[model samples]
Each structure stands twice: as structure tokens, then as C-alpha cells.
Target: MTHRPRSSARRGDHSHGDVHLHGHGHAHGHDHPGHSHPTGVRGVLHGIFVPHSHDAADSIDDAMEAHSQGIRAVKVSLVLMLVTTVVQAVIVAFSGSVALLADTVHNLSDALTAVPLWIAFVLSRRVATRRYTYGFNRAEDLAGLFIVLMIALSAVVAAVEAIDRMVSPRPMENIGWVIAAGVVGFLGNEAVAVYRIRVGRRIGSAALVADGIHARTDGFTSLAVVAGGIGVLLGFPLADPIVGLLISAMIAVLLVGTVRSVGRRLMDGVEPELVDRAERALGEVIGIDSVDRVRMRWIGHRLHGDALVRTSATTLVDADRLASTAEETVRQRLPNLDEIAVRVVAVGS
Candidate 1:
């Protein structure tokens, strides 16, 4: 049922060290022939220090490490947002500031959003089994969808609260407390935003990055609350609701970008720049005549690629050299490149 390459049929005689490669099947101890692999002490040292490994156990270790880093970011942000919400809730009780209440509610919801991502990261660490060959990596993306939904829901809640305040204006108490709470909200959200965005980008997680953006938006909304308080001080009774409405509008606008970003990842879209980088790396290999195709995608924060390369090499040995070289080149050039499948085709074939 499977078609074998003509070159593979002739590769039955090919051997790497003492292991012979069977016809039409490339299965071997090593990923490629003539590839110099770490042995004994060097392999152990590389595994301990570098953390990246070609072995299954080592790969799982790396995956766990990546997930732990993401979880740390979420935990820290969750704590900060919770503290901010609690402080604002206390101020709301004394101030009766509808604008402050709306922001506080949004902050609470934002803090809860981290829970799903935390669980997703945990689920993503599960080992691949027969039923789920790709493992649970896509759990992160699904969690991202949930985050986007939560953000949209927050926008709607903010809108409804704003509209209600506009229709029936109420006297807000402890205006100074409302101002102080706004400043506190802004500081907390901003700090979490900076940390989340930095960690998210480092781990290459679209979900985490979107959550970071959401936190940044929350920071701006907190600023809007401050502006509303100032407007009330300036004798504009409707300013509180108006600013809340503006905050909702800003969130709605940002939702579109997050949707597009998360949707692309769910659909297996890889950045063009990453593909270009792969192609360039493959092209640099001495025996590779041309890079025919390069396809890459992310599974969680890890990257995998498949490339077809045309080689000018006249013999099987030269072709093996091309394949090995291309693998090494991409591994060196790309960050978090988990694995790559390179197909070697003879020139003009």
C-alpha cells in the first residue's frame, strides 16, 4: 500500500557503522546515515546541559520544561491580577463607583482565563500514545480559543454595564478611592502584561501571547477608569459610563487580531519567515542543488518541518551527505526545531 522511492530500493546495501539500512525503508538507529551522534559521556553531558535531545525521554523532559516555564508565567500573572481585583473590590464596596466595579469584574475574569491555559499546558505534557500520535500539543491552541471567547464575553459585560450606567446615573461615593484603585489596576495589569508577553514570545505560544495582549488591554481599561474619575471631578456626570463604553470598544477591536492569530495556529499555519529560514538553511548545504519545498508548523511551542531537496550528488553516499547536512543546518539555524524530515532527490530526477 506504500510507494517506495527508487533510490531507497537501491539503498539496501547501504550501511551506517555496523547497521544495514533495509530496502525501501529508512528505519535505523540514527536519523541519518553518516551522522555523527554523541556517544557515552558526551551524550550524557549534552542531555544534562543543553536539555534538547533526540531521544524520547529527553524530548519529554524538554517538553515538560517548556510547559513549566509557561505555567510559571501564568501563576505569577494570576496572583498579580487577583491582588489587583481584591484591592479594587474593596474600593468598590466603599465607593459605589460603577466604572470601577465594571473594571474590577473584567479584571477578575481576566485572571480566571489563566486557569484554562494552565490546565492546557499540563495536558500538553502527556506522552504520545497509539490513539493520539501527535500527543496533546494542540491543547494549548484549544485553550487559546477559550481565552478569546472569555475576552469577548468580558467586552460584552463591560458594554452592558456601561449602557446601564448611562441610562440610570447614580451618585458615586469615595471618588478618591476610585482613583487610587484605578492606579493600582493599571500598575498590576501592566506588570503582568510585560511578564506574560515576554515569556509567551520566548516559548512561542500564541495562546500565552494573546493572553498577554489581553492583559495589556486591561491595563488601558484601568486607565480609562482613571479618566472617568477625573471627568466626574470636572462635573461631567455621564463620563464614567462613557469611558466604560470606550474601554469595551477598544477590547472589541483587539479581539479581531487575537481571533486571527489563534485561528491561524489552530489551522496549522506557519509563518512565511520560518519557511524562508528553513529553505535558506537547506540551500547552504554543499551537496544540495536546490530546496524544492519546505513546510513547517508548530505543535504547541515546538516546531517540526519537512523539506524536499534536490541534490547534484551522483552517488548514494553523496545523497546521504546532503540529507545529513541539511538536517544539521536547520537544527542549528531554527529555534525549538523539534524534528525535520528531509527527502533527498537526485538532480533532474
Candidate 2:
């Protein structure tokens, strides 16, 4: 019979013969799980008028803050898109521009895209219950799925409108109004696109970033509308429907990219650089034998990870300290880390 050596440090109670390390005095409760700014003039203005911008270079401290940033971006973008759509709709009625009508519909869809994401972020704040041990972080990913679907639907609608216009050519009226409305759509969508993408990257939200890309596609289509209006002014009557078809084709291409991105996130894909960062941070810790494995994934904009490490056979107390230090190192190096589990393995069994 073979016997494994147990040090005096391991004499005390243990679970599965592995030391699980956690930071001392660390709070286990959800941070910013259900937080909101006080309702008043400030909150309303912040929610509507002021654009909330975030920098990708900055580190996010907690999950609640991350979710708030995403919500803020979505809210502001939604408002801007709604206003753009209203203006375009008015023009569409007067000018009878099929291209402008399609752009307006797409812009309205983009505005509504914020709703699912907002709900997802809000749901993410719900405390973990018995039925949901992981909390509601996955809601964000689910919302991402909705965003992809909306993008697909918009493409289909645009294509159909374009095809209908092509089959029965109608004289487009009020070319000036169409051009102005197209300009307005371009500006609105472009602003939302930049804002959403910046905040999304800052908060580590793949879904928000995907939506931002979606808005950027709309902006380009709006520009195409402008081109079509010019073509009409130059006496090319087919220009309106032709540009609409081009816009539809471009949207289809974007849908492919959006699917891959959202699908990857849903499948628990993460950037390789984060794994490298974890290994590097663990390696730099004192008394670590080797970092065997590091796995990380995004739950909403929050990051969670598990790491396995090997260390020299030592007192259980020392092993615990080594593990704790590793956890701290990782927390300091990585942004938006909600929780990290470190398992310590003794060297040579």
C-alpha cells in the first residue's frame, strides 16, 4: 500500500486535500448588484442629455459599476436614435423616399435594441437566489442574442423594401428633404455608435460593443441614402432603390460578423491575453511552484476565473497564504474580476 505524506500544516481540517485561498477581510456580497443614482434633476439629466463616455484603458472596480456604465450608454444612445428616427420619419412621409424610410425603420430598431440590454443589465443586479447560484450575469449574454436577432430582422426588412421599390418604380418627391433627413440619420447613428462602443469596451461588454457595431452599420446606410438622394437630383430615378439594395447587402455582411461575435461570447469564449495576464501574475508570486491552469469568462461585463497552482510541500498555513497572495495578485492585475478561485496543489504529490 502507498501512503501520501501529510505535513503538520495539513493536520487541521481540509476539503478534498486542497487548500482554497481567498483574500482576508474580503466582502462576498455582490458589488453594485442593485444600485442606482438618486432620482432628481441630476439623475434625469445624466440619463438623457449628458453623454456618458468610458475609456477602455481604465480598469473597472466592480460589477455594479460595470453594469451602470453599460446602462448609461444604452440609455443615451436610445434617446439619440429615437430623435433621429422621428426626424427621418417626417421626411419619409413628405418625400416618399424608400431609402429614407428603410433607414428610419432601422434607426428605430437600433433604439429599441437598447431595451433588451437595459433589462439584461438590470436583471444582472438581482441577488443570487437558490435557483440561480451564479446570479443573473448571464442575462447580459441573453440580451446579446436578442441584439443579433434584431440586426438580422433589420437586414431582412431593408432588403424587402428595396426589392419592392425596384419592382414598381415610384417617382421620389422632395429630394431636398430626403437629403437632409439622411444627413440627420448619419449624424445620430454615428454618435451613438461611437458612444456605445467606447463605453462597451470600457466596461468589458461584448454585447454592447456588438450593438455599437450595429449602429455604425446603420450610419453607413444612412450615408447611402444621402448618395441615393444625390443620384435622384442628377435625374437618376433608379438611384433610390439601388442604394437601398446596396445597404441591405452591407447589412447582411455585418450580420455575419455580429453572429460570430455574439456566438463566441455565448459559448464562453474569452480573450487569450487575459489568460496570459493571469499566468504572468501568478508566476510572479513568491512560493508558487507553477501555474498549471487558468480559465476565465465574462458574465455580463464581469469577469470570473478559476486557477490551479502547484507549490512546494509546506505547512498548510503557508500554502493558504501563498494561495491568498495569488488571488490578490490576480485581482490587482485584472479588471472587472467578480470572483477568482485558486486551488493549491503540493509539489510531487
Candidate 3:
């Protein structure tokens, strides 16, 4: 749902440093003392030589960090989806199944869509200049939309081919080969789909999650293909186009649903239920007088936002302590929170 954006104004701003961990998993050292000094050429030179893990390294432009594990999973997913698509396309061509060829073209589009999604993730982390406000927060959302579009386009092309087949039926010669290839593809994609779903959600990236679920959808479609191949093997001619049509329908429905969800987010839908929960949980803390207003948006699946509160403006010292405490408190309350910001405002009568 939606909750206010939260920023982790944690410890110190870690710009560039060597963060070495001890054997026991303790912060051994974080040395960036000279990195703060304005060294024009030397800074750039040191940066090039420094080896920072993607998770460890701050984006040169923005502080919005991405989950390295999740990104890697998508890259792998793209590779698998590509391979399977090719396999299906080849099968469809040799068997003279218009339905399979159409599905193949759809898969090709899915592979092409990955390029922009990866590019957006890298670009979204860029530091915001005077020109672009709110950073590139929606880049991930944009990528998610592209993925939905890719799936939809594939479904449409597949459906058209199925219709053509229905109008002019063609006999498939090698039903056995089609069935065998499809079974292998079916089991392979199903396994990858299941793994991607969990990994994507853990990292709170919508595109990754969507892609994972989409893989599952592909698994079902493959199953449908297998069923169609079995029908062919059994000497049922009409079953091929009929099953293909059913699979096409399922894909189109899923695609439409995906598009709607991403569209609402892009249009700025408020997820107030999450914000209310955040306020209630934070209010339980001793110093927090009342729940201010919490505003939230989807930074992937994680809720990111600011909680505006009306505190007793009397004691500045206690107030700062109270605000920081509340911010940390809220963070622990939710698993999907990336950054939480608390703004203290005095109630004016």
C-alpha cells in the first residue's frame, strides 16, 4: 500500500570510503577522510581504482541504493527468458504452428525490454540536479510498465496467429518433438519463476517482482503449449489452435492487470492505509504526542515518505531526540521501508 517516505538520516553520509568488515561481521573501518576534501582530478582517479561493491558504492549522483542481489537475478532471468523464447520459436517454425511462432516473437520483445529496465535502474540513482526534482524515483516504475507492455504485445501477436490457424488449419508433422521440447521448457521456466518471486520481493523492487511473476505466467503458458502438443500427438487437430487461443487469453488478461496496477501508481495513487499504520506504530513511542500526517509513495514495493507531525515545540532538545527516536522506531516496524523522514512542526492555534 502507501506510507509516507522515510529517509535514513543514519549516522553519517557515506559518500566514498573503504568499508571493511571484520571476520565477526563488525564495521572494522570506513575510511573516507581525504575523500571529503575537494580533490578535482585525484578524486576521480581514486574512484576509478577503488573497488566498491554495487551495494557498498554510493551512486555518483543519488543516495537511492539498489539491491545488488535483485538486479543480478533479473539479469539472469532475462537470459533464461531469452533462451526459452528462442527454443519455442524454433519449434513453432519447424512444426508449422502459427501459434508458437507468434509466441516466439512475443518472447523476442520480452528480451529486448530488458535493456531499458537495466538502463533505468542505473540512471535512476543519479544525483538530482536543479533540473530534475524528486530524483529519478519513477525510473523503476517506468521499467515495470515496459515489461507489462512487452507481455501484452506478445499476447496480441500470438492471438492473431492463432486466429489465422483457426481459419486455415495446417497439419503439424512432428508432434513428438514439439511435446518433448515444450516439457523441458515448461519445467525450466517454472523453477526460475518461483525463485525470482521471492528474491524480487525481498529486495523491494517492483520490476523484479513483476518479472518473476511474469515468469510464472510463462510457465503456465508453456504448460498450455504442452497440452496442445499432446493433443496433436493424440490425432486431435483442432486442439492445437484451441489450446493456443486459451493461452493467449490468459496472457492478455495478465498483461492488462499488470498495466493497470503500474498505471495507477504512475498516476499518483495514495496508499493511506500504510501511512495510518506507520502513524499508529510511531505514536506508541513515549515522547510522540500525536500522530502527525504521513504521506507515502511506492519506491518499488517499499514505502518511502515523510511523516509530518505537530509536537510540543517547547523543548528543542527533547524534540530532536523524540523525532529521531520515532524515525528509527518506524523503520523497525516495516520490512519494506527504504527511507523515512520526520519533520517536526508546532501546532499553531
Model 1: worst 10 consecutive residues (lDDT sum): 26-35
Candidates in order have lDDT scores of 0.70, 0.71, 0.56
Writing each residue's lDDT as its tens digit, candidate 1 over 313-332 gives 66666666556666667765
**Which tens-of-lDDT digit does each residue in 1-349 have in candidate 3?**
1122232333221111111110000011111101121135433322321212232122111123344555566687778778877777777767786545655665555556667767766765565556764556578788888777766765676577668878998876566766755675676566666556555545445576566556656666667667877887787887877887877776765555456557756766534455566777678867556765676666544445666666654555555656656755665454445455566555551
lDDT of 2 by residue, 1-349 (tens): 1113222111121112234432121111122111123245444432332234436557466667777888888899999999989988988888787756866776786788899898998898787777986678799899888888877876787678778878988877677887899799889988998898778877778789778877876777677778888998999978877897887776776566567767877888776767787789889999988988887777777776777788884666677677667766776667666666677777765
- Pick the lDDT winner: 2
> What value does the lDDT take at residue 192 in candidate 2?
94
- Model 1: lDDT equals 0.70
Best-to-worst TM-score order: 2, 1, 3
Models ranked on lDDT: 2, 1, 3
- Between candidates 1 and 2, the TM-score winner: 2
Best by TM-score: 2
Judge candidate 3 at residue 170 and give its lDDT. Answer: 82
Task: Provide the TM-score for each candidate, comma-separated.
Answer: 0.79, 0.81, 0.73
